[model samples]
Target: MPYQQHTAKKMARPTGNVRWMVVGLCFLGMVINYIDRANLGVALPGMAHDLSLTPFEQGLALSAFFYAYAAFQFFGGGLADKFGPRAMYTFSSLWWGALTAATAFASSMLSLFGVRFLLGAGEAGAYPSCATAVGRWFPKHERALATAIYDNGSRVGGALSLPLVILIVETMGWRESFIITGILGLLFAVLWIKFYRDPRLHPTLNAEELTYIEQGGARPIDPATEEKISWLSLFKFRAVWGLMLGSFSLNFIAYFFITWMPSYLINELHFSLVKVGFVGMLPPLTAVFGGLFGGWLGDHLVRRGVSLSVARKIVICIGMLAGSSIALAVFVPSGAWAMALLCLSYSGIAFCASNSGSLCLDIAPTGRHVAAIMGIQNGSANLAGIIMPVVVGLLVGNENNFSHALMLIGVFGFIGAFSFIVIVGKIAPLTRAKRVKVADAGANNEITH
Candidate 1:
């Protein structure tokens, strides 16, 4: 498949590192994405106290976002694939940003749930779009590192939001915190729409950069030439199921801290809000290194002549096994010890998590299907996101003890690892042969040549 589909319009040869600029935008988008999500957890202490929320009610509020987020992943990915990443990303960011700001106006629990649900629906497109864009811009070799840089936004956001959200809530009130985060998203949405483009379509992209991307094997899918793979056909491939189930397991741990960590710090550990802010930042901060390490390791192994498929799987398995330390944290006695253990747990999980994102590109049927693959995995993962908070609420039954929940989370970390090892098999582009194949299908240079 040619990276560029439309060749009628003459274009200038591109110059400079315009592709990295796209990566920068993606990195920023991710930061904004998680900051919006994580801010709620940090501010929940104040918000819950003011609103008189029960533990169950708090869980409901926490999970409500995922309900819509999960539901829309299917829609978001399809839309992004159909409409293009720039438009979908812009709209998704703006909608979520508006909802985050509107959260300031929420007067009751019902109102809050509605706002969060809508926010989830809007943000659903964010990652799929990012994935699709990355598939378009970077080749197989650089993808792990590229994925790490952008996906690190989640950890960085988690790390920074701890202090930033708490400070804003302490000084300006929780409502103001939402508004501030919302504004940040809106600003980034504009920058994304302003600057991002597929390499061939980009005005400023020169021959050097385009050649680098194409040579790297990050070939673009042309809608005009490729047959649409039925959504139902995706399930026949084990990689699809593996990704869905594996992500479900991995995200379980991730959503936990973002939704519950501050509360855990304050209620069980006896940390004040200020203390929670400082203490809670540890795991996510460490995860930044974890993400980098995982990405680098996979790429490094590939450079050392391991097959790409094996390199990715090895990284994922190692990361997941390391993440099982979360289960061990439950046995630790001190808050500081638990924090240290969690730092290890999250680092390992994130290392695997970054590879998982890059792996979607590896296994996509075509560039057009990148967002779709991402959506399937993320949607399945958010099933955990939607269920975990509520499950923890039930297990704890109005107390702060997360022992039962934590154990279940640790189990999932292993499940993610095991699924990747056994079910995913070889990591390569997956598709059934078309009944009526187009000429020169998957030719790799349909337009650029």
Candidate 2:
């Protein structure tokens, strides 16, 4: 069957309630992704104690995942662009799931580090694939909403992890906790493979929905299409550098929260392990709302005739300005109030973050090359994921005060805001070779509508 005809037929009669199912399933994938991410953190104390690891050694082990994860984001993005997200996501889930499960068996630091590094490599494709899926399955207006929906998984997963990990670690040990979470991810992978398809590829989607998506500027990419933008050539474009530097700075803040926040809560805030789990989960919980709130606001602004550039910038600017304030909360006299302020800060960060992937697409503006741009941006951003852990380890390993670390995060947060606000301009594409598809015929339609 011709591709259009196949989609047309499916559009005439989509499968039974698949749209909602697709959303639910993708949500699960994200949930599993985060559970896998946070599991190590939950198990960190046990792992450190069991292996007799020094703080530096533990930091190295913890950072092994980011080193490989960051490096492979480019490869993952390229592969996703080449093969489509369905297969890429499915394979990533399975590979990373198995690796995570295998982490339970590590008797030595070397083995633990090896598994974490491999886990990072395996999971590298997750976000690029999510972006690819959003590009394929959603309309332009709904793009941020869809991103918010999946992005919220990080928070939900983290939230769920605290209780789940505490229970499992208390009863069965950290190994069993890893094994159980790994199995859940594996199960979700099987379900995803069975259920998901591109909108044009799905049997359940109707023509109305497909048309609506196309009307909102979804374009299909031919998987067989092959192209590459060299690092040198990509660097020549100022927009690429802007995104790269912006992502890097944002991630500096992010990695501090992700890798060190729990330690801060336990060591500085004097929270017990179980309490630390719950408290550590708070920022992420607020982040879930922040992502949704930001996405909704950004879309609403777009609907109200604000340009995508302006809308994105406004959301990011507010988020950075407000979110960075949490860093200074470390100095607050009251701990409870301090946590509340930090929560507010992370909410802004989450809201600001929901725009980065979408902004990449805006800059690309034509071809379905988001995964490629994301690869470059994420690769640079993830360097923070790797380096921040090591730096935090050095700063807090000897010094009792983590205030310096918090100060650093605040500085980077402010810097991240500045990059997005100042360096990135007008949401314009860098490549003249890539024509703006929707803009040519109806350049101001969105603005005027």
Residue 90, candidate 2: how far off, in angstroms?
Answer: 0.4
lDDT of 2 by residue, 406-443 (tens): 77777877788777877765675445343233335443
lDDT over C-alpha atoms for residue 282 of model 1 = 91
- Indicate the worst ten consecutive residues by lDDT in candidate 1: 439-448
Off by over 4 Å in 1: 2-15, 224-227, 434-449
Query: For residue 56, what is the lDDT in candidate 2?
Result: 78
Backbone clash pairs for candidate 2 read 11-207, 14-204, 15-204
CA RMSD for every model?
6.0, 5.8
Clashes of 1: 8
Weakest 10 consecutive residues of candidate 2 by summed lDDT? 1-10
For all predicted structures, in order, the TM-scores are: 0.92, 0.89
Cα-based lDDT for every prediction: 0.83, 0.75
Give the Å shift of residue 356 in candidate 2. 1.8
> On a 0 to 1 TM-score scale, where does candidate 1 land against the true structure?
0.92
Candidate 1 residue lDDT tens string, 1-449: 64332221232334677777888789889898999988888888778889998888888999999999998997788788888889999999999899999999887899999999999999999988888888889767768878888888888888889999888988999999999999998998899999988889999988887876776668487777665677766766667788888999998988887898888778777888888888888999899999998988887787666787789989999899888788776798898898898899999988998788897788777778888878888899899879998998787776678788788889987899988877776776765552112113532211111
